[model samples]
Target: MQRVPKAALLGAGALAIVLVVVVVLLVAGGGSDNDNKNAAAPRGGATQKQGNGDQGDAKPDASAKPSLTGSALPNGDLSNTRDMKGPITSGNVKDLQAGWSLALGQESQSQYGSYAASPVVVKGVIYSQDLASNVSAIDLKTGEVLWSQQYASPDQGPNGVNVGGGRVYGATADSAFALDQKTGKEIWSRKLIRNAGEGIDMAPGYHGGLVYVSTVPGNNGKFYGGGTKGILWALDAKSGKKVWSFDTAPTEKWSKKNEDINLGGGLWHTPAFDGSGGMYFGVGNPGPFPGTDDHPWGSSRPGKNLYTNSLVKLDAKTGKLKWYYQVIPHDIYDWDFQNPPILTKVKGRPAVVESGKVGYVVAVDRATGKLLWKRAVGKHNGHDKDPFYASKGQYSKLRLNEEIYPGRLGGVIAPMSTDGKYVFAPVVNNSVTFTGQDKDQATDGQTSTGELVAVDLDTGKIKWKVEFPTPAFGATTVTNDVVFATTFDGVLHAVSAKTGKTLWEQQLPASTNTGVTVHDNTVIAPAGLAAGQGQTPAIVTYTLNGK
Candidate 1:
């Protein structure tokens, strides 16, 4: 990964602290009254209501059989050859000898909100964070809530939740926390220095004995008025003690003189780790003010802005930068390059594939950030195009118009799913452009519908793509060679992963962002409706074979 210069690094640090404080206060101040309103509810389907007893210890039905028996396309790479062991196969369900069942649970409101943070399943216990600022533990087999605890600060966003070594780690605003996974008890918490006004929207990546969390400066107080920078922390997983810190942007003496150059790129996504101890992640849009004069377009500051919009490889043990590939050089649009870089193989090569807001699916060498192939997956409008390639920071006078593809939400809003043979990409269609001074005053410009696309993992060819009437926000889950996704119209549909054929469809109460999770014969989704309405978000579980 490239390193930001010293002067710029200092400014970014100051900006990050201020930004986190402001975003926290803003989040904490605004939504307290209606916090409970957005809580999740149960979906209307074949659900098992927990009886008046210890919900966690409920026994599974003797007739219930496991629905899914397979492995996730291990580490995002398809060609790596993992020992597949799940009940699902590539053939049709009717061709199988065994029958399956689905069960629904309306206990929890929402599973995970907004971003695509994969839920952690440890020791048959599932753990995930909710939009309501609560961490919940549920029985994987039965949709029974084991324990849940809400945080005092409503503004704190629990971006990442992971369970390892009997401890669960999560990041809320500028602080990182550890809790007992079984009992949901706090082990310890640590407060990091964030930018005064910007919010830190990142999940912590856990590997080996350390936890890696990303932070953005400038969100401590109000709005993100001040500039921000990106910082990564390595902490002791159990004790919550700092091990080492890597500043993507390092401070410099002359940074104060040039405020535009002082802005640091924000790290808004969780870092991905290779089993061999390599870490990978991307950065968010550049700030304090985007599209400004000081930091002209396509300017790459050495050291300080090393990994923004760039896929970075780092040593997990030492927190050292190894390699990087910039997806968009000096990104202009708010096209954050922070989507989880799914580690998968393409064409029998060990590769890492990532879908960015720019609407491009890039496959690169996992060991070395070498570009293998790049394909535009979304519609391109041709906005800014330049033929001449100038060196980084050397402003080129050449201007060309290029089509803008994918348009922010059109790219991979959800994580990519694979059955080793094919990759399923959920293309979001929420074409509503938000423009306003504040969130409340923002206008919903237009509504762009969403789609689910199946691509050949080996050839990058489209197998089949299905468009949805309403926008689909949650990630897709696969089992028994069938893919499942939910939309805002309160509908759940299951499609064949191999042929993209609709196998099952059902309607619920509202739109859902929580991705579907499958355990045994049951499929679960967490969802909610718009605010001020009499609807609450819910965790709807469904049994595939209903009476």
Candidate 2:
């Protein structure tokens, strides 16, 4: 949840040659006409308006429903959402008390904290994984362990499992695997990495009869050590067989000519399905980001990297490209568009919404990929405009050591959640100082201050925002009228969804950078960074103190 071992501040990027663009045109409904124009980001600032900006009906698409199905949180089509169909109410949320806690063991320790993903619940079992990609099943009522499958393979962070078709799906550092939902024994594990530079860390997704996983650029403990990489793969869920693979950065082969000097492309969060055979996911950044002393200003990798920092949709059944809208072009900072895309309706039209390290929440037409509206959230200190300047060939004036809002670590590092009417995004205001290009790194040793910004789905405007002292790394989870957010320091807060008023708060056993989940009458959070800060790793649960 904090910075990973390698230079990847965030996971997610875009670029293209003819092959990629032709592949791109297959999804061309979403891309801009050319490189420079795309990099300029059309409506690139805060409180911006785009094609038909959706001020139309001023209501959420009524067909959308909050997921009670345990696939994280379902969107209109569903990725993750704050709204829940659970019985937890604002009145009783304030009455919650500690239910149970399960302390983790040595096997759970990882460089980056484990337990970073929100657990999935099916029947009465909770399915979760840690940083090393170890998964376990725990009883929903009692905190007793049902089954544990330990890979102990050190993963970066944000990896978890999905349950569907009567099986649990997940990934280790280099493979996609499935487990018997009842026994926790391995059903099938398939190796999916293309090169040593690629690994898997995202929670796998399920649709139709297939389990889907994506490749991220990482190896050993280093991040982005390969050429433009991230690829998305869909596998037959029943047999664990490969189905289709889509490269997030198609132009890397054509542009870099197979050189491994620069790294690009990857998906950080899981994906949201449109339910009509369409799937949506965000893509990550290009590198050596901001460039080294020699390739300062990203000179080596030119042109708007197509799929990186973009929101894309594909024909889930065929892995065919549908539409792609590059969110940031030629990104110089660690702006990843890799948050799970929430499929919902805005202005009564089917729209897909996403936000990431770029700190802006955006909504677009689900079918045509047309921009609907964009709202800048958190503290945006003009760094977003750098891409536009880079588009104009004036990016040489990049500042060094200046306190940029939404720094490499700033922005929305985790996925956001949504109610039918509003999207709740976790905002991290961490900053990074770009050392002169002589060194290929930016430095920042500070913890972050964050907040939750609520954006109206129809108007694309800020409805309300609540601040936090610690970084709110977890994705927001909402019940009927309550919004639950977990700060990295382990404090979980319950707020009124309508007024942004604090409803309840509880201190967890240890530090956590993951998300919170609401099921039935209980609230569950997993914490396992058991190192310092007077804390220990454990799965913590809470319920109303008294009936």
Candidate 3:
């Protein structure tokens, strides 16, 4: 997302803050510590390591079973890969033919709304939402609409949709709801957040009879204007009633006595739930960006900004903070820890992997939040040039207008995929010049490149990387032999997963910023929303010509 630059109330410094907010939207886990009585079991299970990074001879936890509502890939069940497994073999995916196409909603540039999420396909039906948060269910085989529901508010664009507890779940600007899966009739809709300026922008997660939704502030300080804020909420999946809520920003440490500038730390992605009742979520950055005049370095509402720009694990049933790992503390770069933390086994040990706008992908011990290994995946000019790249004492340098590679929009912003052994991440490489003017708000007009890199989950080592002509957004899907990546320019490229060789490519209807889902012999994806490019939101399907 892009924005018009804003000027600071106090002058240039204010504009710097304004400049920072635009980059904030460009886009956008863990476990441990405290305690959750309902937590399944310490994620630490004993195992034997093999010479390969893949899990080998690991004793399986009888309790760890496939999460029916977890992310589903066409290859097989996502949970079946605890040993770093992958599709048995790449199917006959080559020589494809376009299947049925459906228009979910009209893309609106004025509203900044587009169909940007991957559709949820379950039980022979496809569930999705458009930029306006219009919810719909379509037949998986025939692009026929089963049911459609529209929204009047532009703020209601849904980030994604989920299905569980015999209902379909989705979150709009400020509310979370569940609709009858078959009828599309609203079962219950709850305003999870009071401030209209704050809304839920990630797909809801379900487990143990509970549904989870996270909130993100409106663009361009809509949150600050309404004196709004952010939080993580849990609800009864069956009834949409509030269960427990966790404030991303707390008043005790993050507030200004006289001002209303305390904000930021929006959750912009889906929460990962371990079957054991441990939930992992990533928190966004702190507010007023760059820094306000009062606090030049953006440390105004400070104290490590508990929970902001960190990976948090909570007890699924009680929303109790268990443990957290802050990736970027007092983040001035708007580097959101917005990516999902993937729960998997590393060398026979339970581990969590996450990557963010900082270009570094990390693996941590699930129960302890201890670093296993961190590797820089995306391309960057150099970290030495980043003003806030200091490993220690980043707060000392609160200077304004410093340049950085993998600059706000340059790092990895989309979701990554992982087979039991390797993690597939789509990388965005570009240089961002932060100018606090209404003109150059962000990478609104900058050029960016993309790369698809495969990293060994066990060693954090790069196996193979393929670069592209345009920057990549959305999610990456992997089959046994092919890795599917959609570029910002609407080109869906299928590269050989084992060798990074180009296998096939298809041009979509519009700029695509989401991932491609291949189920069985069919591939499903949605196209809309490209920063400066106008949108024509549509769901595109592709199937093996003969299949």
Top candidate when judged by lDDT against the true structure: 2
Model 1, 483-507: lDDT tens digits are 8776545467778887788776655
Clashes of 2: 19
Would you give me the overall lDDT of model 1?
Answer: 0.49
Candidate 1 error regions (>4 Å): 1-118, 155-158, 217-224, 249-256, 259-268, 288-290, 293-305, 384-405, 430-445, 529-534
Query: Residue 375, candidate 1: how far off, in angstroms?
Result: 1.6
Candidate 2 TM-score to native: 0.87
- Per-prediction backbone clash count: 92, 19, 9
TM-scores, in order shown? 0.73, 0.87, 0.81
lDDT of 1 at 384: 26
Top-down lDDT ranking: 2, 3, 1
